[model samples]
Target: MRIFNEFTFEAAHHLPHIFPDGHINTRLHGHSFRVRVTLEGKPDGKTGLISDLGTVKAAFDSAHEKLDHRYLNEVDGLETPTLENISMWLWRHFARSLSGLAQVGVYRDTCGEGCEYAGEYEIERKAA
Candidate 1:
């Protein structure tokens, strides 16, 4: 079985690079961010517990507090705020801080469109 929890934060950022002329990102922009974390593992045979929710929550809380309503590009290693890149970066952040994390999803808007990653992730564009 799997257990899941979620966190929300707001942040601002822009790409300083990658443009028609290879210019940095555009001017800084901000958005409300949502992060969903899921954990999957078998319950302990003796304890009947996969993992404690408090443990995961604590880690997520710390991460969110640091990121909420801040300039994401100002944070080292996060110079871009694109949904796909942010999703992958978030997954790595949580995986390092929390144990048993199976996957992560990042929502950048109200619509269902967003990015998701598990373990190592890569974003690809498909032909429509």
Candidate 2:
């Protein structure tokens, strides 16, 4: 079974690296962001549940507090604030808090854009 929880935040950011002197994305702007964390696990024998919904939500409490109403550029490790980076940042911080963490998603509803990511692994491939 799988479970997920989400939270929203309002923050400002700019894509300073995008070229063109007056490119709109290069300008500082605010967005309402929705972040989701997904976990995979089997239902427990006693409770017959994957995990408690409240616990899943609470696991993201630190993330909500850090991202809400802050300038993304100023946040440590979020200087760029792209959707992909945001999802990765959430995964890095909240992975340990919520067991079975499988994926993360970040969305900007107003812009109809989003990104989803599964955590990376250091794969060691054998030569044929």
User: Which one is best on TM-score?
Assistant: 2
- Tens digits of per-residue lDDT, candidate 1, 1-128, equal 98888889988888666565545457666777888889899999998978887887887887787689889877665656677777777777787877788888888776556777787756564444
Candidate 1 vs. true structure, TM-score: 0.78
Instruction: Kindly report which residue stretches of model 1 are placed more than 4 angstroms away from their true locations once superposed.
Output: 19-25, 122-128
Tens-digit per-residue lDDT, 1-128, candidate 2: 78887889899999987557789989989999998878899989999988787877887788888899999999998877888788888888877777888889899999999998898842243454
Candidate with best lDDT: 2
Q: Could you tell me which residue pairs clash in candidate 2?
A: none
lDDT of each prediction vs. the true structure?
0.77, 0.84
Instruction: Single out the weakest 10-residue window by summed lDDT for candidate 1.
Output: 16-25
Candidate 2 lDDT at 5 equals: 79
